[model samples]
Target: MPSDVRALLARHLPGREARSLVPVGQGLDNVAYEIDGELIVRCAREPDPEATRAEVAVLAAVAPISPLPVPEVVFSDPSAGVIAYRRLPGRPLHRHPVADPRRLAEPLGAFLGALHAVPPASLGELVPLDRYPLADLREEAAQEYEAVAAHVPPEHRRLVEDFLAADPPADPLAESPEEAAAGTAGARLCHNDLGAEHLLADPGTGTLTGVIDWTDAALTDPARDFARLYRDLGPEVYELTLAHYDGRLDDAATGRVRFLARCALVEDLAHGLGPGPRHYADAALAHLVRTFTG
Candidate 1:
């Protein structure tokens, strides 16, 4: 552990006995430490106190109403961009193979249903509107595909090219004059980064355990989350997940989900080939074949 981290723990947790303290994850924005396998302490990589504060508040707001367990803030020092919470159970779904993947569908659906039901206005101050337009996603995916296409297998190249040539789905939030006028009228509270790396499950039974990493929570189209589910887990689980979801699932939403899933897949593949960790690239390659072929 770094000297600064040790000092932070010494100052805040004066008498608590910790058998072990070790770094667990180092992402672009934060460094996380596991304390005795029970607590998670995360410190922001940048000095963004406001963002850290928002994450703390969002976790508090989400914990009570979430269908699955979410991290609960136990200690915080927003000025330092540090917070600790009791570690929720289960490993990230991407890292652990579940005995029966189908079993996770219902709970995953219910979890998303609960999140989408929360009025965006309720968490108006803490979460910002996810302003990333679908056009931007398409543009980025195209750029990424250009860089990584040579590495992709010949069999999958045509599928990828076809996706790139296709027109994007209509934006459900901006479809109608009334919805456009209302500004985020069709939007909902969303776990805007609901990828497999953030989803947790029981390795033995495939039970949904918890969701983590709320830094990307936002007021956005619900289809984005659905897209992530489809990209990471595949169609069968995605369809079953939707079966349990109680929110909007019309043709427009389905179109957005499909389009967004493809965009995300391309982005992940590119990242995996670049500065991202080997696991990211490995997972993306596996999903790419599964996503395009299946």
Candidate 2:
């Protein structure tokens, strides 16, 4: 199989041999192999042709514009559900503490700023940004809540719902998930799956080196990016991220960010409650208490 993958790359690359190929990563959506430990070859685990094509198109367009290193689709064959690209440096951010969160925030903010600034029209036939209608998110949140309703402590269930439904708090630190669904922030291209796991980082330097997984990329509320920042690193990092951004997210936009942040916690706690750490649930509980009391 390594020989086959290498042969595939050879065909596309012409002169360069894609060597030392070995399976390196596997997940729900993709199974990846590193070639010479410098390049990555991936195949979609499912049958999603449109997504395969869009990922290639989006990467090709964004790599040149992104402030951080992004994968280049060195070779792609949607018909075979195969793709190859030069791997960027660093391990996944989730694997290490961002040593100096403050310093990393500056570049991360710049990276997202450049990402959002990309012209969506240039994305061509790739999936466009989702509007993520207020109604849809509300329904999704309700569904996620229902998924875990049985496990929530009886006393905390109602409070959970309120947090999901309330408007942004008058205070920036306090707010509801609903307000996050509705905010004044202008929409732009977003990495719909910009999670901590997707952020690649240099542990030695405490700096992010790359952003990955654009299969779900689209133009959506900028808050989606902000929300992930809030969830993965907490509000302090989120604030630093925003402070470094070239764009401005007004007060209403902040309401949305806070709400979405809370929603992220609830969605996880409510629907995925067994056999894993409760860190997210704990965070959600703390925010819920702060929201209800303040």
Candidate 3:
């Protein structure tokens, strides 16, 4: 299969001799292979027109404006569900935390600051958020809550359930219940799935090399970008990251971020319960404890 994939991708990489096609990545939505040492070929695991379109479009638009390097789409054939991009340098951040989490926080924050600042009009079409008239989002979050509730420890169950409710108190952020219910403060382009796995950095220097995987890129509440910051790093790093942002997220904007944080737990818990290596549910429950109690 790898050889067949290599043959298929040969026409795309015209000059460089294709040396090896190594299976490198398997994310929820995509399966990726490293062709030679320089490029990546990815195919969707499921039919997602929006994700495919985003990959083809968002990368080109954000490349010049983003503070960090993003993948350069060398070739794409979405219809065939295959696209190859020049693999960016460095390893996933989780494999190697930035040497200086403090300094790294600023640029990361600044990068997102710059990222959100790019004119939305220029980004072409991206997946829009599941916003307003909360019927759908509420239902989805409830489903996630149902899946995770039993796994949550007793002490944290109430808090997680509260957040899972169709309407819950701010718990931490958001201006009002009404605003929280609506799920929109200000909408902008978002990586949608910003996590350590998608962030690449130099193992030696911790210098961030790139922000990859824009398949879920969308025009949504900016907080979606920051949801993982505090959970993955720490408050200090989270604050520093936010401090460097050029754009301002007001009470409303930030409120949505917090709201999304709660909303996102479903996926987090699911990943933990699913085939992942780690028991994310434990961490997920711990996060909930901090959210309400801390």
Candidate 4:
């Protein structure tokens, strides 16, 4: 543990000694550490501290209303850019291989639906939608695709460009104006990155025990949350999960799902081709093409 980390922890959790600081896992923008016994500390790597503060605030606000258990922010010091939370019980859903995806689908979908049901008025000021806009995502994809096009095969490059060129769907599933609004009224407190890794589940029951990682939490389109399920789990599981949520394969929802799936694929591709690219990019791209075209 860094000396700075010890000092930071000492400031918030006074008296108690921070026994062992072990690296927990890699986060998109923050480094996570499992503090002594039950506490988890997240520190910002970049200069920006707002993200940490926002996460703390959002978690605090949503803890009472959220259907599934959320980590409680026990200690937070935005200046030090470190936030501490009481670690919940159970392991992330991804930790144990899910033998039957259907069994887990209902609980996951219902949990998400309940989360979306939280009135937007309840959540205070959240990050703007423009920050996570589909247009911005598309632009980023185009830029990243151009930069890495040379390394990609000619055939793959053409296909990616063509996919990028296709316009995104306008109709969204959450029809209520409140549901449509990104940050203000329509936006529910959303766990923007709801992957298996973020979900804690009981191995025996296959039920979601807790939802972790609030760094990307925002008040945005509920469909974005559903899109996450589609991308992380395959189509069959995705369909099952949506069905569990009473989500129909309507044209509007389907179109939006297709668009978001493509966007997520592009996002994954951009990150995958970064310094030490991961192999999952190929799978994401393949899935994107199949879903969009089919």
Among all candidates shown, the one with the greatest TM-score: 1
The whole-model lDDT of each prediction reads: 0.82, 0.70, 0.69, 0.68
Displacement of residue 189 (Cα, Å) in model 3 is 1.8
lDDT of 2 by residue, 138-225 (tens): 5677788887777677887787677667654332221345435543135567887776767888888887888887877876777778
Q: Comparing candidate 2 with candidate 4, which one achieves the higher TM-score?
A: 4
Question: Against the correct fold, how does model 3 do in TM-score?
Answer: 0.81
lDDT of 4 by residue, 1-294 (tens): 466677877787788687888877665567778877688887776735777777787787777766789988888878767777887877765456466766777777777777777666666565434235566677787887776666565655666777789775663345466544642423455688886668787777776778888778776766677776676665666677777674333456655665676667666666767742364455456555454454
Give the least accurate 10-residue stretch of model 1, judged by summed lDDT: 170-179
Identify the runs in model 4 with alpha carbons over 4 angstroms from their true place: 47-49, 93-96, 130-133, 148-162, 171-186, 202-205, 246-251, 275-294
- Candidate 3 stretches greater than 4 Å from native: 14-17, 47-53, 124-138, 165-185, 275-288, 291-294
Candidate 3 positional error at 195, Å: 1.7
- Whole-model alpha-carbon lDDT for candidate 3: 0.69
User: How far off is residue 225 in model 3, in Å?
Assistant: 1.2
Backbone Cα, N, C clashes tallied per candidate? 0, 3, 0, 1
Candidate 1 lDDT, tens digit per residue, 1-294? 466666777788888767788887766678889889988888887757888888888988998989999988888888888888899888888889687777888998899999899966577588988757777778888999999999888888998888887777666556467557768756788888899888888898788888988888888889889888888898888889999999865568877887788888888878878876567767777888667655
Per-residue lDDT of 237 in model 3: 73
